[model samples]
Target: SYKPNIAFYEAHGLKGWQALEKTIAYLNEKCPDHFTIADAKRGDIGNTSSRYAKAFFEELNFDSITVAPYMGKDSIEPFLEYENKHTILLALTSNVGAFDYQTKMIGDQMLYQKVIDISKEWKNSRNLMYVIGATKAEYLADVRKIIPDSFLLVPGVGAQGGSLEKVCEFGMNDQVGLLVNSSRGILYASNGRDFAEAAAKKARELHVQMKKILINY
Candidate 1:
């Protein structure tokens, strides 16, 4: 969260995304223990997405990434080719506009549910995961039922009005398969050089909260 995940930089422009690569490299070198993610919501034709996979996994060497699943299974398979690296497919997103398509009822199931169901069909699907936004807290149980063992990269905790407790209640598994991210809340905690330290403090706070939650279970 402290490090603007790749998509934040990508949102700026191509140069910004390149800068994001450099930033991940610097973070890996400077803070070896930190987790780095390329938040690129990429999912396209096979060859195209494969190239995107090469860029992120081989060239940039990000630990994880966010991907879109609109293009279907073929668009996602190439990303899973990279061993140990993770591909987080967008399911339920934090944005208000997510309701435009995700919530539309379909045969008594939401559209996002169908995405999760289809996503389970890909090779190495265990390495693949879903971005189940904390905003749609109520749907966590349904998503969990579809893929109980798969990891979920959750966002919208702090600034987006998502409840940590509720998400954990419905989604937590034996291995704690949830990464609840708080980007803006942690990053913009301060604007000065102390920003990093402030961000770390916020992360620590969330960590404490997470620890307590884990303890209860």
Candidate 2:
């Protein structure tokens, strides 16, 4: 299985990030079969992004990292350089604030559609993926026009109220290129020490749902 990108942990904080690392290690040890992601949403100028890439892909040993693309192609190129690793770029976000920019029409197409088109030019971008908010199911068909093959990390399922059936309906691909994330809905399922068990249970529910979704493809 693939990993859930950065927003999942950042919403927590420093302590939560630490918990994320420990969780990654535990999962890597116990469920080595599944891929791990550092949803860091990090991207800076020059060598800054390089170090961010190293911390997540090297030091933390995450299989992938989420990066912002607004700074320019160079800011994202370094993260894309990581071998066999994924770089999930923020395309269309799930929040209401997304209307502040993502939905703005630019001569017939949304701004995010242009970003997706331009990203195809970056180095080693074949490993590049996009962050598509699950709430915007209607936009998935349009997004598919730009990046039909690349994977998409979709958030806003349970707690955010994005429907699973709707996201899969528009986002599923031949390679099953959709990673639907549910963090608070999964992690904080309980306040007890059995939180990890609860998280696993939540993950299992999503996995079961994913299995059914995949069968349709």
Global lDDT of each candidate: 0.85, 0.84
- TM-scores for all candidates: the values are 0.90, 0.87
Worst 10 residues of 2 by lDDT: 1-10
lDDT digits (tens) for residues 50-153 of candidate 2: 99988888888888888887898989998888888888899999899988988788887888897888899999989898999988888999998888888999
Which residue pairs of candidate 2 clash?
Answer: 5-39, 6-39, 6-40
For model 2 the TM-score comes to: 0.87
lDDT of 1 by residue, 1-217 (tens): 3225665676789888778767877877898777667877888999999999998888987777789988899999999988988888999999998999988888978999988888888898877888999988888999988989988888999878899999999999899988888888887889999999998899899899989999999
Per-prediction CA RMSD (Å): 2.1, 2.7
Model 2 misplaced stretches (Cα beyond 4 Å): 1-21, 192-198
Q: What's model 1's TM-score?
A: 0.90
Which of the numbered candidates is closest to the native, going by highest lDDT? 1
